[model samples]
Target: MASGSPLQPTLGELIASLSLQLTTLVKGEVELAKAQVAEKGKSMGLGIGLFVGAGLFGFFAFAVLIATAVLGIATALPAWLSALIVGVALLLFAGLLAFVGKKSLDKAKEVKPEPVANLKQDIEIVKDGFTS
Candidate 1:
């Protein structure tokens, strides 16, 4: 009904503006948290990949070393006996590795999502909103 200074707002108008600003801040923070979690998750995946690579490299290196040792032994013995002995040794090694791997796998726990902390605090805030 009346003109007012452009620099000043009525109480209700000021409250509405503050509420909107608060909501924007909350949403911005939520997006930031999501981005940070995604970045960290990517880094964790890289770390796991490096760990697997190290394990595979070690396995291949050990196999190479064993092959070199077996070649040396085969040269000293008769050809037929050397081949048979090496064949049995390799089969036994394979079986033992398989058993150990199975045991380790059986002892592993399945990965599952954990419940997020602070969910109770979020619920409490919502409950207080109804009361207020």
Candidate 2:
């Protein structure tokens, strides 16, 4: 056989080169995936943090509005009495909401799907067929 030239590779060398290249490609792809996930995670974290900040500001704004309502009422009544009236009204509204929420939950719990009954009947029929 003629001597192999510099440009010619044996079968084993070609396989080894292919394996090395594939491994490098896979590693590069994994690194790229990791970096992409990290960037998305940072973006999601920032968005959630901004939402929380907005919620905090909204809460403060709502409190200010409530205070303004109390001040308005105080002009016509004693400050303490006006505040107490507003507090009681808020409590009553909360209680009404709680009662309605509980009723909705109870209704949801009471729902029995027809599919479940049909499934149970199917299971019983299968069992009876097996016994026969």
Candidate 3:
């Protein structure tokens, strides 16, 4: 068994193997990137949705306030008094929005792209095996 023919590889076979392995590696990377991008896209979409919801709600509130002023129920009060009360309420509402926006940003910032990280790790393991 000591003497044997050389362990030779034909060009076609070698190219084929390399091509297959390259394709696999590329596919794995694409999968990982897709997972990460998908997660980020999902978060982006959610953020946009939240902003849209807030805008709609704010529009409704604004209309309601305008309606209240138009209804003339506050006419019993002095004009200056009514204006002062509305100003205070607006200030309070603005402060509440600031507080809420800060909290929402904090929560959203905490969202990690776990799907991407896990997929990347998996891809790395396989890639390493192939390279090694």
**Top model by lDDT, which number?**
2
Per-residue alpha-carbon lDDT of model 3 for 23-117, expressed as tens digits? 99999999999999999999999999999999999999987886577445367887667767777877899999999999999999999779988
In candidate 3, list every pair of residues with a backbone clash: none
Task: List, residue by residue over 69-117, the lDDT tens digit for candidate 2.
Answer: 8899999999998899888988999999999999999999899789988
Candidates sorted by lDDT, descending order? 2, 3, 1
Q: What is the RMSD, in Å, between candidate 3 and the native fold over all Cα?
A: 13.5
For candidate 1, write residues 3-49 as lDDT tens digits: 55678787778899999999999999999999999999999999999
Model 2's alpha-carbon lDDT is 0.94
Which candidate should be chosen as best, given TM-score against the real structure?
2
lDDT, each prediction: 0.85, 0.94, 0.86
The clash numbers for all candidates, in the given order, read 0, 0, 0
Give the Å shift of residue 83 in candidate 3: 15
Better of 2 and 3 by TM-score: 2
Model 1 stretches astray by more than 4 angstroms: 1-9, 97-132
**lDDT score of residue 13 within candidate 1:** 86
Per-model TM-score on C-alpha atoms: 0.55, 0.74, 0.42
- Give the local distance difference test score of model 1: 0.85
